[model samples]
Target: MATGKKAKNVGKGMKGKVKETTGKAVGNESMEMKGKAEQAAADAKQAGQKAKDTMKH
Candidate 1:
């Protein structure tokens, strides 16, 4: 896997977690939902990268 891309996905996942936690603490349902979506997208991206790397090997 590309180190830069992998780091980006990890960063996105971390960012989403912060957003979700902050939103919940502040009672912002919309923000929380957005955070969850972001996390899911990051997870998917990471999975795709892993699969691609596996195929290459």
Candidate 2:
């Protein structure tokens, strides 16, 4: 049972992956770069949340 925020972040990361793959398939460098950045940001956010949760335990 994941929290809503965590689920959202995971969803965002998944969407970013799709965008990156689609961009690459279409040969759109800018879109691919943007997607990669978005994915990184989402992953960082998720990691931060996990750290926060661990500290509370």
Candidate 3:
């Protein structure tokens, strides 16, 4: 069973990827930039979750 935070972070990253791809297909620069930011945010969150989980063990 994965931690909720980890799962959510993974979902967010996946969603961001979809958004980025869709934006590229449609030539929407703003959407693409937003998706990139979302992905970066999700990555940061996942890193934080990993650090927290490590401290618990």
Candidate 4:
């Protein structure tokens, strides 16, 4: 079973990818950057959560 934060991170990352694709299709640089940032943040958060889980074992 995945932890809550891990799941959330994954969901957020997926959402960001969708946004990024949409933005690119619409020629919106700002939205694309925002989506990229969101994906990065989600990745960072997921990595942090993984580290914490590892330390717990």
- Residue range 1-57, candidate 3, lDDT tens digits: 257878899999988988998999999999898889899999999988888878888
What TM-score does each of the candidates earn?
A: 0.97, 0.91, 0.88, 0.90
Candidate 2 structure quality by residue, lDDT tens digits, 1-57: 249988899888888898899899999998898889889998999999988888888
lDDT string for model 1 (1-57, tens) is: 899999999999999999999999999999999999999999999999999999999
Per-residue lDDT tens digits of candidate 4, residues 1-57? Answer: 257777899999999998899999999998899899999999998888888878889
* Alpha-carbon deviation at 1 in model 3, angstroms: 9.6
Selected candidate, larger lDDT, 3 vs 4: 4
Structure candidate 4, residue pairs in collision: none
Candidate 1 local Cα displacement, residue 20, angstroms:
0.4
Candidate 4 regions with alpha-carbon error over 4 angstroms:
none
The lDDT of model 2 is 0.88
For all predictions, the C-alpha RMSD in Å is 0.4, 1.6, 1.6, 1.5
| Ten-residue stretch with the least lDDT total in model 3 | 1-10
lDDT of 1: 0.96
Query: How good is model 4 by TM-score?
Result: 0.90
CA lDDT scores, all candidates in order? 0.96, 0.88, 0.88, 0.89
Clashes of each: 0, 0, 0, 0
- Runs off by more than 4 Å, candidate 2: none
